[model samples]
Target: MLNIPLIGLKADQFRHPLDLEATNTLKQLPGLDLMVRQLLGQLGEQFFMLENLASSVQVGENQLPHLHQLLVEACKTLDLEVPQLYVRQHPMPNAYTFAMRGKQPFVVMHTSLIDLLTDEEVKAVIGHELGHLKCEHGVYLTLANLIVLAAGQISPLGTVLAQGLQAQMLEWLRCAEFTCDRAALLATQDPRVVASVLMKLAGGSPTLAPKLNVDAFLAQARAYDDLSSSELGQMLKQAQTAQLSHPVPVLRAREIDRWASSKDYESLLARSGSVCYDGETKTKGGWRNW
Candidate 1:
């Protein structure tokens, strides 16, 4: 759980008040922590507590050694020590990280995610997952996944309670995602790269990606803005993303595109220094900074 060194490490440490407010709101809620503690074991076992790490045909040292190299390079660039990474067989393009404070951390990437993305886009995904680790989002996201899976098991009125709480969580998840996207930007030090990843995720197919246009995708994002501005647009948006886990891909693409060019993103990179993965740095000196 890295503290992100918001103040001194980067000039772009503009903590979104919404992000802070959400964190505070979560803390004030009674029993959620206790509930998570009771439930985490059941959930963590699905991935974190497995008997053996997934066998990979390749990793940083072998197989797609190129990707492994990229992962190591990204970690080095971000001043983060390399964590173990795994690729799993799955159709959906995705990645996730799991770790608790003082625990071993690791990341998983779906084969499909890699299949559809370019090497640079893949780095953005790696950086995005690293964003979770940097922001200490693993524990919460881990528990949230469990809660969603167990949503229907709460006995009577379980569905209602689950739906209500899930909506609250979805809101927080969206904003937290934004914070992590910034982390990815910080790692890559290139908004266009990050934005291009978003663009591919939005409309890229295996066959369509060779010709995918970053500018056209951005234009689509701007078009989305225009579309969402009208009266029908508001209703459409409310209907579209009301149930989504991640923010809409175009919206995320648009956001990264905008933030990439902002003074905030650049300032963070300028202030951030080169990191050596082989060396050690004090993690945090304060309380549960998350």
Candidate 2:
């Protein structure tokens, strides 16, 4: 598939309004920037980097070159510098990234996630993680992960503080996910590819992924939206997601579906230059490949 490289693409160009608003809200909170960058930044980066180096296989031209290609291509599409990629052995299908300003950034994909997704879908997952980097979301996201990991060790008063911080961080995290999903869409240039990944994450295993239907899953997302029409349903929905880090899969899928057809999406693509082709004939539209 051919993709246009969104040269000089800015996060605000495709950032979800909710993400923007929530981020602004987070910025207003006292001392978060200092706590995240000065307090947790270096320690978190070192910890994750060391762990990956010890326990995970890094993807590069000489190691897992196919996955390396996907990462490089996705970065190119998003106008991002390629970050280190690692595949770790794990039962759960998941991928995450860690980055801090002035530090080497990296992404890790659980082996099971690669098993569950097609090559294209894997690229979309990579793109999703790259979204975090593109938005410079590393600082706060690192704090959020550190909080979850250290939750059981805090003192009572510290626990209260952690809880308060966690709640706000989780809300921002959820909204940030919406923006990342948009990044995934920008990288793939195909809504179905991004939505399929979410569907698979919702309820897919290796055995079930082939049988799962993207269109049906999107319809289910619509159904979920309809379910929130009533006041009670809306309250229930809010309660369900209040403590979650990512939005419910159906809601994420629904947001991607809506945004893909929006004039804004079209306009962004129309404005972007630089095309990447998969071993196809070069065209006048600035065809390039990684």
Candidate 3:
């Protein structure tokens, strides 16, 4: 294990622009951290307890060795410290990253999602989850999911608190997800791989997964982007994103599409030279200047 300190990567190195802006916006909200800490004690417990968690396949050398290898490879690429992985048996093709302020952190991937993607695509998803940990997103994401879960399972007062907290968490998460998508992009280096993962998640199964077209799906994403270019369109854009926990999938794809071509994404790779790229760090793009 490379013991190099990765904390120096900083927000500028890999965090998505929207995630950066939303995080700043969220910090301005009153008592944000207090609300987060207060709520995490309750919310954090479910992630660890057997009764609260649904079925999950924990990975190690003994189980899912292929996935274990992918996790190790992606972690090596980004210089992120590896966290434990849990593959939950869920029909939904979804995955999530978990972390607290500092105590416990891990990533969860749905079995269905694993079944839907290729090995490379799967690693991209792991990289996406790792991006959250890299950026310290586990705190807000935990609190947000908890607020929504609490609202549904508890009393009226809980509903009010959950509504307020969930809205904020959703707002933050939507952007954070995009940031992590870039992490996936960097890991896969194939925009099609990233886009296909989203498309499959939108609608896919073990049977239909093989036929999904990455190019056609990317076109769909580009078409979706065309919807927000006008004055009324811009208003709808604001309304559209204001309440969602994730950017609509197509929007996310388009964002990744845009970012994959941007100087920011290129610079990070040029400097970091991924695990597949080189051994000695060159500090390209003046990364050392940061």
Candidate 4:
């Protein structure tokens, strides 16, 4: 894996504009931020951490060594603090992150997900999760998780607040995923790797993964983008994703394709410094001037 070190990586460098707008909207809510942290942050983090410790396999140099190397290399490329990684047994292929202040943050990947993706693709998944921590999406992400989990028990007054905030938070979360997809692209330094991961997630199983064609899947994404040209089609598109936690897979593929060809992506890559990976030193020193 090529380590393209972004010496002073900041969230804004890769943050999706929609994510910025939605985050600003959430911040505008009076007392919402403080209320979320004080009310749910502490207990929610503890619950997730304990659950993972009991149910997941933690990765380290001595365990899943190759996967551990990917995580270390990606963190170095993005200039992020390496968080704990855990692989949990599950049939579904997926990954997620839970982070909080004053506590150890961690990323969890399903066993099936690792089974499906290659080493570079796995690194992209790891980078995508790290983007959440880099962007501080956890506070709101936890709140959204809480709302979904407790929606049935929330009081009428709490329901009113949740109803209003849920829509906004869901939208923000979807946008946040876009930013993380970009992070995946940066980590892998290959747009095709990011798009391939999304494509596989859309429908590829262990049986069909080897037969799937990435070029054909990308063409399908273009067709999907074309479908939104009409007004009714646009509405249909919005309706299809209205309640989704992440944007539909084709939309994500399309976004990465566009960004990969954009000047912004080109400039960022041009400005980055490359680190050669050897057995003795995991990464060589390099820094971005601006």
Candidate 5:
């Protein structure tokens, strides 16, 4: 299999505008980044490391070679360094990444996600998680997770801060997922493959995955766009997604579908051959400077 690498791929090339806007607003918050990194980043990293190490199966050449190959391929396709991959035995289909500026980063996938997706679909999931790293989302992401987990235990001032930041963080997180979905498309070079993964996640199981129809799911995505065109429908849509960390699957499917057909995606593919690999590696080691 000939792999056409997206050499020199940068997150900005595909980052959703909403993600950029939300991230810019979040960064304007005075000392919020420093405070979160100083107060909770390292501790959160340790907590997740311990949790995954105790319960998840780590992927390597010696174990789950096929999935490991998918990880490697996705990393190369996106021009990113490979992070550790762990498969946890959970019935729900989900995956997430954890990374820090100067600490080792990793992605965890629920075992059920693997069971529900084919090798190509699984590659899309891996690519999506790698997107989080490529964009350096880990710092604030960890802080968001920590805030949600420890909101009650925080001091009154801290609670107020968390309350204010949580909505913004959640909004950013949702937009970030859109950017990652584009990453998945870049890695697979197949929009339907990415859309199928979303469709499956919306409602898929090991038994039903094979029977599902990607075309129908995509049509449904379009239908959703039509339904949400009215003012009342738009408000309902906002209410449906305001509290969620990821955009609804149909919305994601529609977004990817539009991007896949846009001139931007076409231009990107045409330019892929000209962009040579820079041979830079993304690895974290020193904690003192962080």
Candidate 6:
């Protein structure tokens, strides 16, 4: 693929508007930031780092070189430093990232997720996780993860407070996902690739993924939009998603389809230079080696 490196990309240049709004609202809540960072930050970071190092296979030049190449290319394209990448043994097809101040950021891809996606789709997934880092979503994201873990163990009085915080965190998380989808698109330079990843996640297994159609899935996304056109449908939609951390797969695919053709996406790429490289080896182009 002829990929472009967004030489001086900024998160705001492509960040979804809803993400910005939700993040600002999070920022306005007094002491939430300080409390999350000062209280839970270091412990959470250390714990996750140790857990990954112990249980996950870290990707690098000598190990899982292809995956490492994907990570390096995506980071170069997004103008961000490469973080550690780990493949963990799990049945769930999911990928997530962790970043916090004074800690080495990292991304984890479930083993099942690797089996479910094509190489390009895998790259898009990496890009999506990197989006959280690009936008500096570490603190709130760590808090959200920790909150879920701690919610079940809290005292009765603290449960109410935890629930309230969890609700807001989930709302922000869903909005944040849209922005990450955009990042995936930016990294892949193909909306179809990003949409395909969503489609597979929605209803696909290793066997089913090969048979799924991106066009049909996009049609289904449009249907979903129409389904929510009525007031009751809108309410039901809200209720269904209120407690969820990520946006619905179809909704994310729809957002990517819309944003990929937008002027903002085009303008961002227009200002950048393309690199001539296939998925494997890099070739010469109008890009600099970072």
Please give the clash total of every predicted structure, in order: 0, 0, 0, 0, 0, 0
Error of 2 at 216 (Å): 0.7
lDDT of 3 by residue, 22-136 (tens): 6766556577666776667456645564532446778878889988888877776656667788888778788887666444567888878899988988988998988887777
Using all chains and alpha carbons, the TM-scores for the candidates as numbered come to: 0.77, 0.85, 0.77, 0.86, 0.85, 0.85
lDDT string, candidate 2, 114-214, tens digits: 99999989989999998888887887676565665576367777677777777877888898999999999998999999999999999999999999999
lDDT of 6: 0.85
Clashing pairs in 4: none
Model 3 score (lDDT) = 0.73
Where in model 3 is the C-alpha error above 4 Å? 1-8, 25-54, 142-168, 237-241, 273-290
- Model 2 CA lDDT for position 56: 99
3 or 6, greater by lDDT: 6
Give the poorly placed runs of model 6, Cα more than 4 Å off: 28-35, 142-165, 273-290
| Tens-place lDDT digits, model 1, residues 18-101 | 555665666565776556645663556455636226454336686678878878766655556677777888787788877564
Q: lDDT of each structure?
A: 0.68, 0.85, 0.73, 0.83, 0.83, 0.85
**58-123: candidate 4 lDDT, tens digit per residue:** 999999998899998888888787889999999999999977663678899999998888899999
Number of clashing pairs, model 5? 0
Worst window of 10 by summed lDDT in candidate 2 = 281-290
Each prediction's RMSD to truth: 6.0, 6.1, 6.3, 5.8, 5.1, 6.2
Candidate number that wins on TM-score, 1 or 4: 4
Candidate 6 C-alpha lDDT tens digits along 14-54: 88897898777667767767888778768877999999999
For model 6 the local lDDT of residue 52 reads 94
- TM accuracy, model 6: 0.85
Quickly count the clashes in candidate 4.
Answer: 0
